[model samples]
Target: MLAPSQAHILVIDDTPEAIRPLLLALRGRHWRVSVATDARQGQQRAQLLAPDLILLDVRMPGMDGFALCRLLQASPRTRDIPVLFLTSAGAADERLEGLSQGGVDYIMKTCEPAELLARVQIHLQLARRRAAAVDDTPAPPLSPDEVVLRAAMRLIGQQLAELPPLEAIAARVGTHDKKLSAIFRRHLGMTVFAWVREERLRRGRELLADPLLSMQEIAGSVGFRSACNFTTAFRERMGVTPSQYRKGLQDGAAGKGTPAG
Candidate 1:
């Protein structure tokens, strides 16, 4: 497990106010956090600090989130750092775009503070687990299949936000749709569409934990066409409505509060 104090977070966003609340929220959780206002600076900081995780904004004046994600993934020095997209665009297409660009996750600006913290914790946990596995390997070699899978996964993650038809992805991979689907099922243990939905929900859950974003914003950010649809899907996957889930988390936190006396 990654200790809260040892966990380093790099937050990339252009808005100063947006950065403040996020920093404050993470600080409250005892996380060591770094802030960067643009992709260029963020990249530089990432090289220097090698943060455990990166929270990148989707839209910017130049060199947007997608470009930055590709750059990071291409660099041998920084490819291992997990990236999560923080953006105002929540359309299915937009979410898919972020994922396909090599981001580990996506988050809407309308997320609750607490929910945001929980996601940070979860990703950090995953990163630590992955790091442990790497440490155990003396000189692990990448297989050709892994290379292909990584490429395909990157494409899938980036394009999901657009909700591209299955055929398009298959075409990009130079394979038939049915064949690609079978490959996904064999390797990832799920259909391509199912993987897309799962990725969307995973991002949605992270957004739901943040108090800063509204339910509607979260809905849009995670690719649901409307709040109603988002809520329904969320309920289906999580066994609770978005509002209810947030309430439950709040209630749990309250229950764990130290006594005032």
Candidate 2:
């Protein structure tokens, strides 16, 4: 297995100026970086090197990033490599198409070098961890509907203190509330209310694990009207009080490190 720091990174972009900074960014981090000026050569390089990750641009001469992504997915040699699209396209549908075609994530071209490097490192670590755990198991690409659902879920996660109404979230994701409802029911077998409540409790549990936050603060953060309401909802989902759960986790972690007798 290639070490994450030494992993090969292939950048496929038609423009020389766009490629320069990206090359500088990854090579500076001690990664082995390769460049292809067009999608055809990029595809060839991808097959020959079987790179650890790919940074693809959307616009190229013959095959754009979206088309090349399909080709990559079709080939066993490059199917599992993570691809992050770097393009100026910011439309929701464009993002949905990119995710549907098997790209790991989409990034804007104008983003700072630091942000790009951080995203690259993060995905590389995740891919390495996944490869170590699984036997090159291919992940099913998300459908356009699933992409929208994910966008909605992300909005909810970000605004837990005051979640927008379902209508607002649907609008943000470029769908109607009724359509979002049907999509959720079809894919998740749950209504929006159920998903939201579960997400709140889930976040509450994570916040409780942090010793610095008070119960009242965690409660307000997760959208509960009061600490009592938060505790009641938490107990219902976790089958224990939040306080008990926190202490149990700390105790378990402490015991987990003790040497065997």
Best model number under lDDT: 2
Over 66-138, each residue of candidate 2 has an lDDT whose tens digit, in order, gives 7677667656667779999988877999898788778999999888889989999888999898789877655
Instruction: List TM-score per model, in order.
Output: 0.52, 0.51
Instruction: Evaluate model 1: give its lDDT.
Output: 0.76
Model 1: worst 10 consecutive residues (lDDT sum): 137-146
Candidate 2: C-alpha lDDT: 0.83
* Among all candidates shown, the one with the greatest TM-score: 1
Instruction: Put down candidate 1 lDDT per residue, 1-261, tens digits, no spaces.
Output: 356557989898878486567678888977888888887788779877878899998777555777567667745557788999978879999898788767888988888878788888888888888888775432343332343355556666655456668776665443457876877887889988888888878888888778899988877776778889988988998999989998887887888895777
